[model samples]
Target chain A: MNKLKNTFYPLTAPKLFITDKLMRLLLMGAASTSVLVVCLIFLFLFKEAGPFAFKPGLGKLLDSQWIPVSFQQERFGVGSLLSGSALVTALAMLVTVPISVLVAIYIAEIARPGEREFLKPFIEILASIPSVVLGFFGLLVVAPLVKATFGLSTGLTALTGALLLSLMAIPTIISLSEDALVSVPYALKNASLALGASQLQTIFRVTLPAALPGIVAAVMLGIGRVIGETMAVLMVTGNAAILTASPLSSVRTMTATIAAEMGEVPFGSIHYQALFWIGIILLVITFALNIVAQRVLKKYGMMK
Target chain B: MNNTADKFILLSLRLITYAIVLVVGYILFDIIRNGFSALNWQFVSSFPRRSGAAGGIFPAIVGTFYLVVGTIAVSLPLGVGGAIYLAEYAEQNRFNSLIRLAIITLAGVPSIVFGLFGLGIFVLFFGFGPSILAGSLTLACMVLPTIIVASEESLRAVPKGFRDASLALGATKWEMIRTNVLPYSLSGMITGAILGIGRAAGETAPILLTVAAFYLPRLPKSVFDQVMALPYHLYILATQHPEAERIRHMQYGTALILLLLVLGLSLGAILLRTHSRKKFRW
Candidate 1:
């Protein structure tokens, strides 16, 4: 295009023709790495976990006691871990979903142009804050506050973990569902307004419905984060592994089980195998959640 | 009456947003303010004394720096190459969608699972042991989805006319991408990488099983040697240490340092992304 263009490296016949096959192969291999990684993770988890995962009998998994480290009798029951994870995740979602949707609506519909622009990136920064740091906040700050507020013996209960996890989850929900709310067709909201609906009604009744799939996907992704979080829950949940769902009680989550115990266990021991089994269960749960979220995101034509 | 109801709802929403923002602000402020006392010249430079009670965290800082470098080296090319194939070359089909599905699934499969995978495969099957090499490769896998998604978005953001112009000047397809497309998208790609750096640096789980050492106060001589990291250091001090009450300030300082490191990188990425968007607009 330029009258006298000077190129540092000009393409030659050998260079042009020679790289086509190599480039194609390399790029193909690069793309396939994702699939390969996922497959290998599942294979490795199952291989390490299969023998003892079934040795305890599938029915025994519901025994409400997890004594994997017992010298007297080793049992690989996952009931308490599963329930504990569920309770923490449920508490997190109860706080995350509604507030996230509200924040999304506020940013997308109510905030001024400048405010919207400022708020979106602010949410991204919030999302970028690491989980371990949040765990730190929970351990030093929120746990003490929760203890003071409720007159509990210790602050590091399931509630403290849930509260911090909710904090960690909120930004993901906000950023994603904000995209969803923004993508709802403008005409739909305008039509509601034209038919004598209030601006709030237009947003809640029309725009929110149109964006529900995307919002749901966002919530699912947030749940995925909550369920998989390790450091924060491990730090603050007290790691008692009890068979209760009370928010005020100490608990242990499956992810926490792996992170807390993996280092101390002897290699190839039943305890080690049971941790891998926890890993397998975690993988399957998260995989299911993500698949549903991906399908919803794809169906909504919302991916940018 | 209608206006009053609408106004009330809007006010409530604004309050909720305020509450959420306040929590984040509170956490950051609490960390920085309480931990500021621990940030001294000696603290950042000297080695930990008495197992992380009163001394510095130089080894942990250096280890985290090395992990970031190793992660970028391993992930940048693979992520960019894969994204380029998807955005420029791959046809839209079931197989391509399956690839997308696989990437998303991998991303959401949890860091703890990645930790296990690293322990099983890298530490055992591949015989790398609990070293920087295993941790970096595992983190490379974990960050691949973020990098690929970001790179593909930026690549797609490049104007199609530039590619056409390059091809019209008798340039081959590869040459077109090399000179015209990549230059415009480079900022976005770097932004993605910076964000990944932040995540990789602050992450505890994947490295917990792979590379992080509990009490290695000295700097690592090579990738094969285990090293202490700020995240795992903080984890140990807060949760497992017998003297958790005694060295609480050091724990806050470590948290503050990790937070600042990750937050600084993320801030750079957000700014660069804003800059890229402004520059790429027609």
Candidate 2:
């Protein structure tokens, strides 16, 4: 039987075995590339940002002004930028979370099958619109309307940025929250309904509570997206590093600061290092948010 | 009283949903309504004049095309191979879970951070130097997580019976995957790839630092040459141009083209996904 098999298959089992081993190695290498890339990103960002941390010291980051290009003295205080990012993200979340959760609930529970099909794709399309295009819309269309309504001079304020950012973030929250809502076992809803609850009551009392963890995860992810967004905010936020809480005032996010300054700052200069340091901060924030979000989903068995 | 409250709440939800839809519709209508006046055959086919304030956006379109192709080339194989390993080979353990965490983190990394990383690695370390090669690699890294997740889901969707049957018939593991597994999952993989392409094409931040030129209207002869991209082009026109106000028409035109390209890719992916669902039942 061995001789017959050898005659039929000229390529020996040893050769096939070697080929399989090589392929597995190649595939493993490919799989591990993502981990390697993540490591390299942290490494390089820290490498560039390290020098600035030492020479300037981390205290400079706490200063309230961000005049990096001043002729006599350059300040790298990120307080205002941090405040700006926080303000925009906070405002965006304030607007986005309620609307997106409601939309998710509507789609998951209230919409007819045909309406769900129509609305789902519409939201996905909204998600896929390029940020730059939305920024352009904000610049020409929304900015003007905002300026006229608020009687602001420039119209590029935190409010405008927050509104557009909320738009950008809405799709993410809705989709993920929709998934969370849909995953609630029918038994829970049926029980709520059998207990003399209406559809709205069942959704609000049973489904909403069950999906809360997932909804929180979705909102965190949305906040991460809003915080990390660069181009749109840069174009629409007026790029002012002002320490203010008013949404009508111009603000500069850490992301917009890096994007706006990185292009002009000489390589290896303090300004460049400052940008890299900002990159590190952004990376760490988003990383933490993502990890927490994933943990929430995993702990609740909301994600596969 | 309870009935009135429920009616109000449901009515508010329905109104808000419709409002969201209308906002999206208005944005689209605004762009298409204004963009048509600026778009002409000559505008799309001819090269820019006077720093993109006048003339066509041919080079930007071509550059974007080159980028999408390059991104596909670099990412598709790596993503698919990674998916195969994860779906078929990896043991469920701490290490694999760590890999999953890394992918999730990578996906959540901001695009600008990706740009900075690309600058450090490809543009400086590898000496690709602000070129399409650097940009494509950057985008590939950005989109890798998406492709991996999508492809893995598709791979997992194939029934285990097919694989068992092939292996039971005396085929090697690779032979079983090649003959019975991969063919069925290719369409789904392609659908994911298209979604990734849509994202890569639309992203401006990664390319801004790594590859995009401010006004290089000429087509790149080599991957090393910096090329103008659609998103960056619109950005400069809308924000940085000295004649930004004068060039409103051009800005709208560029925005329209980019909007169509990205939305069209997304639409195609959606269609392809539905078609694959209908065709492949098992």
Candidate 3:
């Protein structure tokens, strides 16, 4: 085909086909636009955030208060929000990682074919549920239960936010982890079984290890979703930017800070810059998580 | 003894899986029970009265519809075009990997950050203000990664043999992609776009900082107008309403509508994907 095309190609260099070259370049330009958008996000964030982001020398971010709208001496200490985000994310990951991994294993190794079919779609549907509804549910259901159980002043706490976020992250974890587990070679499991290993042991000792990298990728995805969740956490988290580690404490997250405060802040104000700085931080962290996940998948030969 | 232990472990896993299912069931049941009470046609069609103390979420519904339409317009063409480049044209090299990395990174960026980007670039920088245009562009960027990845996967699913055959029959690569690859992969692409729309409709974060209003309960006159969206409206009612506890049923109703809209689109996508897989099975 190459020879035939060359013979018919205006009797010159094949690359001299201006139309073909132009079309290829057009596609490449469109494709690279995604990269350009990514660059633009980072640049725009930094451009908007740079002045205030550096004014506090980065360590002021560790200050224990976050009163960006004060009558005097506005404090941009994200410590409270950072701690809140950490506390909620830690609790959320603690619940979701185990449950989601177990769910993936069940779907991959234990569930009957009929069960698998139903479970997959059900999970997808669960993922499709809006975060706001989950937030509402947390406010209505989980918050009250937590408050009643713990004898708290209000149900709004890191616990409520974490619980809802864990629910939200589960589907991402289960789906991706299940994909990895499903791709594990059947022959490897069979070999373990033939060696007198129990079905459970084969799954645990062989399949899980083989799928480890992909599972890591899945967990990273869950981490990305959980930390980035805004509405549910914003609603149930009490929005109190307090520097406390207790799950019972009402704390704000970096995301909730932006959403709750950005609406009222004057454009180009220092407060606006502070919020953009938080966004830049989020962009960096999530980008890092995503790149690491992609690298893991590529290394495991699962990424195309 | 080992068999018994394995049985216990497997049983526990299955129980947890069922627990997850039950959790989902409980949420749906709760939403429906409360939302059903306030879901009369009057509530659905009428504008809010008494400063959201009573009446319907009509403007929110309309605004969300407009945003979804605008988002699909912006994302679909670019996403499909980029996917075509990735699947058909790009060589296996550093540049391609970098593009993939960018897509993955874009996908993972928190929607709030996209909200910020939209605030910076679209609203402030481009002077679109807090309007529907800003919100749609923000959402389009956010969903573009999903569309690109899904479309690329579908494009890959189109058998290389088809492309080869087209080329052998004297078709250019562009011709082969348009007539052969695109037609076959379109179902998957549309499925992806459907899922993207669902996400876009359900999203509050991107719009919160870009175009969502605190309580503007009227439909917008143009793309430059700020509008009330369902997710943001629900958020306000759930958390910020001074009488949030009093308007509980109304909040649930809005949530239920948003939930149904999003879930319906996602269900449609899943069904189409299943159908496409069966039809295109090698």
Candidate 4:
């Protein structure tokens, strides 16, 4: 028996050991690819963007007018695009935050069990609807409605984009804030009720305060999404790169500028490089927002 | 008076919730109402004529199918492998923490930025030249975080006793995971991958710069060739086409198809997840 076992075991054990080590190495390499890709994204964006710093110079980005196609000269100001993004994102948050928070409250606190089950997945379906379709809806349906309602010559305005963006932002904020509200320990609610607090009072005074950090994180993440959103804004907002604070006016965002011009711009030209520079700006802003949100979640132990 | 105020507030919240639901319902209703008329067998099977104002959307449909195939090919193995490493092997350490951070950051990076990265790396550096290969690679990166997170969650859900039993029976670690862990977690992983593919299918920004063609009415002969995707096609039809107003029916038709594709995949994922939970109770 010992001799048979020795012969059988020696042949397979070493082979299995070798394969196990190899597989682990392969998986580790696969896991590390994300890190590598992140590094490459940073490198490539800066490499392509580096040329603009020398020719048009970084200072040119501050100019308020963005006219890449012109007869005599080109202007690569990113200020207008920045303001456009800010205007749309601000308006979208204004609309989304209140509605999402209330809906989240209803889903987590007020709904019956069966209703919660149905509502959660229903909202997820809303989340799953493609942004491009949303953009299409905005273009054909919402844009016309806006044009008629506001007495504007055109339906395509910053407000039109804002409304569509609000639709997109709603799912994200509701889901995350719902998770926050749900995670608030039941014991706290029980204690609040035990103190003779009304259901509304308990939710507002106890649950909302406890889940504030997660809700804030959720809102920040939603804003990150709005700021980075491209196609919907590109379609709904009239692609005019002019600085304006009015929601009723046509404006172009940083994302829209890149998507619109990258197709037509000559490769390796300053215009091309400027688009990459804008990409870098977008990368930095979204990265900072994500890191901050992650930090908040981690600090509050709400990451799960 | 306080009770009356509380009652009023709760009622207002309920009304607002229903209104949000109504708005979403209206959007879907409007699309189906308008788009159903334009969708036909001829429209689905034929190629476009007159700058997409009059032809069928066969080429765009085929292009999106190819993209979904290619994205699944590239992302699934890497994402699942990454998940296995994180869930089964890695210890608590700074390096692992950094990898987690990278995954989170990757998830939050804007889709347009992904387009730029794909343009710079695959198109420019690797010389794929804005083809399906480049676009698939770009999308794989974008959706990797979702797959990894979901897969790891499922992997962790398998009972520790199973792993211990396999080990006690003299099975190698890899053998144990292969036979015991992966089988159970596969449905969850596929659900995550399907969701990722859905996102890839709907994405226009990343493909806009990497792979999508403006008016390619023919099917791509190879991965190197650019093709017309449904989302990008819808964008062109709705906004960029010179006869955008005249082609309103076509725009709605494309939107309907794309919406059905994405939402159908998501619904499948949700259903599969529920079914798996029922089947794999332990």
Best by DockQ: 4
Return the lDDT, model 4, position B40. Answer: 97
Pitting candidate 1 against candidate 3, the one with the higher TM-score is 1
Worst 10 residues of 2 chain A by lDDT: A7-16
* lDDT (10s digit) by residue, model 2, range A1-304: 9988887677677777788888888988898988999999999998877788789788888799999988899999888999999999999999999999999999999999999999999987788988999999999988998999999899999999999999999999999999999999999999999999999989999999999999999999999999999889999999999999999999999999888888898888888988898899999999999999999999999887
> How many pairs collide in each candidate, listed in order?
0, 0, 0, 2
lDDT per residue (tens digit) for residues B1-282 in model 2: 999999999999999998999999999998888898999999999999999989999999999999999999999999999999999999999878878888999999999999999998899888999999999999999999999999999999999999999999988878788899999999999999999999999998999899999998789999999999999999999999999999999999999999999999988988999998999997
TM-score of 2: 0.98
Model 2 CA lDDT for position B278: 96
TM-score, chain B, predicted structure 3:
0.97
lDDT of 3 at B280: 81
lDDT of 4 by residue, B1-282 (tens): 998998899899989888888888898898888889999999999999987999799999999999999999999999999999999999999989989989989999999999999999999999999899999999999999999999999999999999999999998889998999999999999999999999999999999999999998788999999999999999999888999988889999999999889989998999999999999999
Q: What C-alpha lDDT, on a 0 to 100 scale, does residue A18 get in candidate 1?
A: 68
Per-prediction DockQ scores? Answer: 0.80, 0.83, 0.68, 0.85
Candidate 4, A1-304: lDDT as tens digits = 9998998889988999999999899999889988988999999999888889998799999898899999997999999999999999999999999999999999999999998898888777777788889999998788988999999999999999999999999989999999999999999999999999999989999999999999999999999999999999999999889989999999999999999999999988999999999999999999999999999999999989
Better of 3 and 4 by lDDT: 4
Identify the CAPRI category of the predicted complex in candidate 1: medium
B150 in model 3: Cα distance from truth in Å?
A: 0.6
Model 1 scores a TM of 0.96
Look at candidate 4 and tell me the lDDT of residue B122.
97
Per prediction, fnat is 0.79, 0.73, 0.77, 0.82
Error of 2 at A262 (Å): 0.7
* Local distance difference test, each candidate: 0.88, 0.93, 0.89, 0.93
Ranking by DockQ: 4, 2, 1, 3
